[model samples]
Target: MDLFNSAQGKNISFVRPAYFIIGGFIGMAHVKFYFVFLFFVYVVSVLGNTIVMLVIYLDHNLRTPKYIAVFNLAFVDLFGNSALVPKILDTFLFNHHSISYNDCLTYMFFCYTCLSMQALNLVALAYDRLVAILFPLHYMVKVTHRFMLTMICSFWAFIIIAVLIAVGLITRLSFCKSVLINSYFCDHGQVYRLACNDYFPNDMVSYMYPVFIFWLPLAFILISYLYICGTLAKVATVQEGLKAFKTCIGHLSLVAIYFIPLLIVFTLMEKIHPNARIINLSLTSIFPPMLNPIIYVLQTQEIKESVKRLLKMDRKLQLKRIAIM
Candidate 1:
């Protein structure tokens, strides 16, 4: 309390709390089952994303510019889930609801950063598909490994800075009122609204952050697909156009998985029950990481064949070792 009271400004003194209570899952019936499901989702997400990354790393055939985005997506998904799910379980399931002020901000930073990257990563994949489908002749020259790495790295740098700014704005707030954040995690909007001081900056960020992370990325992806469609229309035959478009199915599935639930929940947020909304939001956060690898492995022939070849090699080694025994 003494430490927080020392933060004095021109005229106004700030009242910062030592900790905030997370009551997102409190007083909800059958919440334990949701935690169990989350555990299952986390386990599968870890295994699936790990496999995808390992396959991409071990198979030289999978090291194309396209797979670079895929590899990064897997890494982001793994890191995102690792950042969110465990803390959620510990907070709600194990009854560790009180989060220190600094820890809550750190939690918010990682969760928001990873969540923002998920959207921007889709933009990277969309760019890869756009160039590959629209400009096949120049795809090699345009979408080199170095170019893809640069794009992904640029996204990382931009999003880290942006999220840091958002988190930084939260520090300017003075939570003199109730420190109970009503969300599942340390949500940005929930945390700032509890402040007694001027939170107009935080409120502005609440509006702008969604535009950068959600709307802009979705717009880019839609426009890219429109361009892809326009190009495919001039193909020699219907089958050729279909064949070209088939390559985008995995990416399309990913976009749908990532965006659709959030869209629905946000669109109907006022009408939905608070607990239901929280559950839906939690699902939106956790499901994509679990589903992304499955979609890619099943939809992309390259990844499927890589998995097959690796499995066959492993089986052969086992057979040889058994024969030796």
Candidate 2:
């Protein structure tokens, strides 16, 4: 009460309690084990994405179009995880579940922005591969560094505008209920459901924006693959066709890993309990970033060889150290 009053005196438009209690799997069984599992996922997501960025930075051969998209995806994942996972850890480990109304909005904005950027990055990746497999001879000319830079800049601009619009709309709605957000992080859906004013516009944007941001990119990816498959079918030899198709194997795996859980979770959202919903949401959010680097590391021969070479150098350095000692 004191905190809320003081904040109100200072012109802060906060909920009476001044914080929203995040329903981060409250009353779930074996919560410690859940914390341990989520902690491991957080570590893997951060470390794996870091390694992806570092590997792409250190290897000159990976400075091309496809790896550039991969690098951008890793970067977005790292930022998104940084924004979301720490709050989750705090909630589970330290019982700090109260988030201020303003902070909640900020977090939601960043999460959506990263999500939008990731979808755009996937589209860029699909286009990159489409050009490579469909027009191998002109891939370099068509997908130049300058072109990629322009695309990246344009994407950031578009997402910033979109996020600002959504946030602006959300901030206008009034909330007078108990400030309890029924999710791990501040989901926009959960937050806006507490609004006391007209919320139909917010609902419309919430549901419709996803179609443009998520489904459109998905459609583009499918079309790109269709063209890629057609082109591969026309290749001279079976081995050549296989080689071309193999290049997309990692991407296909990544897309499946990222999207399938989300689809299932969305489909079953109403059927599941709140705790189950939080667990499902948290897993679907974190797992893709954690496994993305692993998929690339395992599936791409170039990255595997790079890792092996790095290991060999470490071994040679160890031998030199022993000799010196």
Candidate number achieving the greatest lDDT relative to the actual structure:
1
Question: All predictions: root-mean-square deviation over Cα?
Answer: 1.9, 2.9
Give candidate 2 regions above 4 Å deviation: 1-17, 312-325
lDDT of 2 by residue, 289-324 (tens): 888888989898988887777778789999999999
Cα deviation in Å at residue 63, candidate 1? 0.9
Could you give candidate 1's per-residue lDDT for residues 137-216 as a string of tens digits?
A: 99999999999999999999999999999999998888766888989999998899998888898999899988999999
Model 1's TM-score against the true structure: 0.96
- For model 1, state the Cα shift of residue 92 in Å: 0.9
Cα lDDT over the full model 1? 0.93
What is the Å distance of residue 299 in model 2 from its true position? 0.5
- CA lDDT, every model vs. true structure: 0.93, 0.81
**What range of 10 consecutive residues in model 1 has the weakest lDDT sum?**
1-10
